[model samples]
Target: MDDGDVLTSAGVAAGLDLALHVIRRDHGSEVANAAARRCVMPPWREGGQAQYIDRPLPDEAGGGTAATREYMLANLDAPLDLAALAEHAKMSIRTFTRRFREETGQSPAKWLTGQRVRHARHLLETTDLGVEEVARRAGFGTAVSLRQRLHAAVGVAPLAYRRTFRAADHVRAAAAEEKA
Candidate 1:
């Protein structure tokens, strides 16, 4: 293949995997991993929507909160504490605490919970991984924890969320196929 030329699989999903592979090659694994993680995409795509998924934005806007927001989003699968986040933002725990609430209109803990829930939602939609794995990846740490958080966020269990979204996807796919 020439420099400008590329090869891809037959399905649109395969094309996305090829694009992600190129991204991983060009930008290094960390960037590619973050991109994939934010979209709740698996490292390998086999008829999946990783390539076509829209990336979600973090809550914080520009200014001092930008760096902290990036740090939070990048580290969602890890334990996050207010002190650590404040330190990352290079502000005192007190000031950072206040600013975080002012900027995002949610406490750091609440924000983190929301982020995790969002991640969980994505995982439910796209991946076939079990709820435990989804919980871990979403930073919930355990299925029980994920259940509580997801319930709080959306008033439904993770499995139910998966079933709902998956069914929805299937219906959409059938409709599209019929049209085609």
Candidate 2:
């Protein structure tokens, strides 16, 4: 292969495999593994989206609590509760709960927790913050809470997660510096 070479595969499955192979070679297995785990994707699918597969399409219908959801995302560090969310949405508690479930397929608390975990994961992968700092930034209130939540969500400790992603980053940075 040459510099700036382009290789195209015939099918989606082959393309996925080629993409993963490139990532693995460039970033190492730990980074590729971390990407696969965090994306909940296998890196390559055997038969890409076959007719018998059950893949739900995106929801084109918009309205109902989307604004509130955006607000929640913005104020992740705030001590938000069901009552706060309901008030923001101008919905009664019961009505908000029902609508939230219908829209997200999860309870408000569950969804919020998942989002917090995702934030924590991003911090772990991208930042050099300590666990306690990451917890505070991720809105987990405390390191213990962050650890418990992370364990429950992704079955890995914060340090381990950071190691997998950040170590790969450090390696890439060093390689770039060396080339420079």
Q: Which prediction has the highest TM-score against the true structure? A: 2
Error of 1 at 21 (Å): 53
Residue pairs in steric clash, candidate 1? none
Model 2 agreement with the true structure over 1-180: per-residue lDDT tens digits: 213577666565566666776788799988877777776678645643322122232242674877787788788778999998999999999999998888888888888887788888888888888999999988899999999998887667889778866887899899999999
Relative to the true structure, how large is the alpha-carbon lDDT of every model? 0.79, 0.78
Give per-residue CA lDDT, model 1, range 1-180, as digits (tens).
115566556565565666677888889888878877886777664442222234355444565777888788788899999888998988999999888888777788887888888888898899999999999999999999999988876767888878877998889999999999
Q: Give residue 76's error in model 2 in angstroms.
A: 0.8
Q: RMSD of each candidate?
A: 16.4, 11.3
Candidate 2 wrong stretches, greater than 4 Å: 1-61
Worst 10 residues of 1 by lDDT: 46-55
Itemize residue pairs with steric clashes in candidate 2. none
The C-alpha stretches of model 1 lying farther than 4 A from their native spots are 1-61, 172-180
